[model samples]
Target: MNKKSNAVLRLIGILLLTIAFCVLGYLNAKNIKLGLDLNGGVSITYQTVEENPTAEQMSDTVYKLQMKAQSYSTEAQVYQEGKNRINIDIPGATDANEILAELGEPGTLQFADEDGNVLLTGDDVKTATAGMTNQNNNREYVIELHFTEAGATKFAEATKNNVGKRIFIIYNNEVISSPNVKEAITGGQASISPIESYEQAQKIASTIRIGALPVSLTELRSNVIGATLGAEAISTSLQAAAIGIALVMLFMLCVYRIPGLAASLALFMYVGLEMVLMQAFEVTLTLPGIAGIILSIGMAVDANVIIFTRIKEEIGAGNSVEKAIKSGFEKALSAILDGNITTLIAAAVLYIRGSGTVKGFATTLAIGIIISLITALFVTRGLLTAFFALGATNPKLYGIKKETKVINFIGFRRIAYSISSLVIIVGFIFLAMNKKNTGDIFNYDLDFKGGSSTTITFDKDLSMMEIDSEVIPLFTAATGGNASTQAAKVAGTNEVIIKTRTMTTEERTKLYDSLQEKFSISEDKIVTENISGAVSTEMKKDAVWALLIAIFCMLIYIWIRFTDIKFASASVMALSHDVLITVTFYAVLRWAVGSNFIACILTIVGYSINATIVIFDRIRENLHNGSKKKGLEYVVNEAISSTVTRSINTSLTTFISVFVLYIFGVSSIRDFTLPLMVGIVAGAWSSVCIAGPLWFDFVILSKRKKEQLSKK
Candidate 1:
């Protein structure tokens, strides 16, 4: 084949693969699982009747509930609350009442005498199975129960004492069955016969098998909650993503020209592949998950920017287009690998350690990172080569790097440190002030602090959009806190549930009057009850531990990759700076600290570390290649100067993506994107100003310590 023909074929092949991925993404979009916040679900809480339940008992119950709920959908989440409550959120479930009816009451199952003296609790049942039995030529469903050795002995003795008398099988203090003791059999098994149908028998058997909760439970509150955000939220987020991607593509094209186009194409494929993989893996998507996907797009762009920057430099150094392309990717490899691997480590740890929502974020993040890496490394390279082979090989087309003097960023290090210290100290001051004024260090939303759930039956059907826009503000205004609304699952009734921070009586009354006056509904129609926070203390602990472990793992990886502990130390210190700064924003601005708080903090940790690694990689490279006569300060300054353009471009593109999200997304999504935007800027600043300087300081301190020791 001629050169033109080969290039045509390659381009066609890339187009075809892109098309295939886009088609698959579109087809599978509906199949992607959405979490409880995105899809309406049954949110039910069960409190242990016992005053104090053992942790073991609660854990066992939570595990059993998780298994049971997963039977409905693999995305179901069952978690423990405060001390003795278990919260089960089964996403995509419409009817709360149906779920309640079939969920089977989790309580003690007692086999007792007619006098009500208990013979055996559910703990004694080893297993339960449902089967058919024939009696007098009629087939009927039966429940077969297998007992533990102790249970068998107890049952045999009970039957012996109550021969020919009625013995009761009870569940939740209600007699479910009463049968005459036919004989004192010593067998370790028994059968409950003459069930109406197989379904009933199975239900009974399942209840018996799973009913062995160490502590009895009572339904505290059961709600069929609608999606936290309405359909508009999804639509707006998609719009933001589309607009952001277009802007990024335009920016790339105007700047990098041909290579920019190739990167854009790769980005499109990245998005499509992300959608397809998420569906294929059955990863649940939530609002925070969406944020993660968008953020990863920015990081994907960062990889391409790094490579293209290197390519431009190579070309400026008088290399051919072909050589530049190859050398560009080669030189960019270490930074790309180090950055993505470190972030991937964080995502992996978060997935393993986090609960439902955090796990969703981690899953999407990991998928995006892997796909972006492939697209940047392989797909973008292939396209650039194809375009080059097709005859667009002019050095000007891909832009020539202009030589510039290195800026002494190290000279300004003291100013940067002072600014950072001042900001962080102010943050601490505000935290203290908040604690003193509000009895909390941050604005804890309903997810963090237990709140009130108000279920109201309206006179007319109000769509979820209406509840979000029209109803939520009323509650928020009245309660002076963030409020989330959910539509009730009942078919005909126009019921909506509003959740907010625990409201005082006056606030409740004010809300009641406002709701009644606005909708002209009767006072009796609305009902409110206090509910515990969805984010538990244990979850908070898990998030903290996960982040710590992830940071440690990333530190080790950076140290090993760069062959210096100083790089790892500098990276970790920069990460802390970013987090602390972001938290300061959260404190000063008083953003609602909810589930998104964890997502935000973890995201900053990942973003900052990746950014820091890029600069560190550059410094490492410069150290080996640059003149040994140059001082450490000159080497660090030159490395930062060379990579400064790449850093700014990447951060700008990322900021553009998230900025659009903030502008176009719903209020809740905006709340999420807000802190994220702050984090992105902080990450950029620290990578440029903080990370390199910190490394320099560490090296200086180490050398001085060694000199002192030698003199001694």
Candidate 2:
């Protein structure tokens, strides 16, 4: 056996390089900003009026009040939070009374007299929009009144003798609606309902109810983001990142020595590249993204571990130093590529399928996977080549200890066969159960379903129990469901986010009407986000393309690196198998419950790539050692047998991390992480049991063709 490989020296180098990056990441942490999800701010909701007033009117009123509020205090930033709320973010100002002075500016109301004399008022109410409910159908509309009670009485008196006289209804000094008096009225109950259609009535009614903002707001929940807090989160994340990298580096160095030093250098390269790529992609560096960085750090090391293990086996088999270096790297190459590719697929799927915070982590993980691949393949190899060129021959650096390759993995192919069948069957069973119960076979998220979300700010503090009682039935019934209808039960969820299952546009319109009747919301507040079918299809296509492209690139990489088509084929085939199985899991779950099944499938694709790469690494090493061997199956089996434990262990470790994320992570992100956990196991299994055994068929066929060509 060749004993010339310097495993010890390589480990030491990896360790040293790891430390360098730890320090850099720590120092630079201050520059990173926390995304919106981590540091929450005020989400104020105005009481929706039955009629939606004109935007110009709302803007004019809001602008005038905002200016008045600013004059009283210059610390407010007012923004249209959504359809029904004006968000005033006041830094360091929480008192409602402080800004009350700005309220009631341009006071438009009048305290009038019955004789029509000049009274205590800034202006007579020329026009006022009122929201009223229909007694029979319970439908509501916006009523524009041209006169106050006194004016109405006087108008009614005048109109009694002259029935053709028109009374103009004006609001905000504009004649919006005019309805002639039908008869003289003695009381103050005269109503003017201005509506061309039921829909228009609802819109106008909503606008009327939002009413005019009295004095602008005194900041409540203002100063949501302080410079100090922003700086602190940045500093904290950086410090944590630095400490983690340093600790990892130190651990690698002490444990693996010289090769650790090499791995450390590779790891640093990965970190640097990841930072640049993340910045380029414009992915917000949130807490979860930070966690992804940490996970990638571990993954980068796993690549080095695969290489080192192969180098040790070569040395045990009596390979020379130069031979071991080439063979080990060659052998380890497939596993490293396959592992990173799987992760990339998962990340890509996540990036395409996920929105908001899930995208943040997915983007980061994707970047990390690509960068880690570069470091593992290029950076680590570059560093090792340099060491070898320097004539530093030490076995300890690479950590290659002589050991025999025992136990024919091919002999155990039946067990692998058994596991694969069981997995497929179990997957199908889940799919069947999911189908038997649910009709659609997949559930959709709010984004795809055109959901209506309203955050209502009230003068009172109402708990969710009260909200559920008041809010749910109104919206549900409005959406065309019976008020007493049943909605699919969302797991582990309370009334915080009350959502209905997917509803059609007509249903949505009906729901809008119902909710207006129920909540007295203005038309604009009834925001129904319509999702386009084209957009959904595009998203699905993009997700699938991303995975295909990633695998294609990895296949090219394997073919080029190992100079073996069979190796590339095996690696990609395994990755595809993993992806299929992962997708099957999603299908099963979708059929089992109900639509966002795409998110799970996306996560699974990325998660499965890792397993494919690990197995490929083993195949490459065995092929390199037996590059001239007749029995390719023996080499393939040997490679699988050696790396099984490491692959399994790494899979387990990542699974643990994903499990933590799945269990403790925010509810909004659970759907994203849960699939990844299952994908990890499936991915690992395919890499070892699936990708490994299948390569022989390709190899035997290739050889048979080659022999036929030689005879020709």
Candidate maximizing TM-score: 1
| TM of each candidate vs. truth | 0.82, 0.53
lDDT of each: 0.83, 0.53
Candidate 1 deviation (Cα RMSD): 9.6
lDDT of 2 by residue, 1-712 (tens): 1222454465466556556655665566444444433432222223224245555544544443333333222222233433434444333333334433323213233322223332222122333334556767766564644555565566556556445545543334444345555766544345655455554544333233222333222233322322212333344545555665666677567655666677777767677656655555545554445555655665566777777667777776778766887898887775666566546655665554433333455666677677767777766776776676566567656666645455566666678767767767776776666657754344444434323333232334444345546766666665554222211111122212233444567776676676566556656644433221211333344445655665676677667766788877877766666655665666665522212244455445555555555665656656667643847777777667777766775565455555545544533335555666666777787777777677766778888999999999
Q: Please provide, for model 1 over 1-712, each residue's C-alpha lDDT reduced to its tens digit, 9 standing for 90 to 100.
A: 8888888888999889998999999987988877676776788889888889987877667755654564455457666666787878888777778998888668778888977788888777766767898878999888787888998999889889998898887777777667778888688898877788887777677677667667778888787767767677788888999999999999999999999999999998999899989888878787777877887887789899999999999999999999999999999999999899889998999887665456666877789889989999989998999999988889999999987468989999999999999999999999999999999999888777767778789888888767766788888789675554333333345877776777889999999999999999999999887666666565677778888998899999888998889999999989999999999998999888888888888887877777788788888887888533599998889888888899899999999999999999877788899999999999899999999989999999999999999999
Off by over 4 Å in 1: 45-87, 95-214, 218-224, 480-492
Off by over 4 Å in 2: 1-36, 39-277, 285-291, 314-366, 373-400, 448-452, 460-535, 552-569, 587-630, 701-712
Top candidate by lDDT: 1
Global Cα lDDT for candidate 1: 0.83
For residue 225, give model 2's deviation from the true position in Å: 12
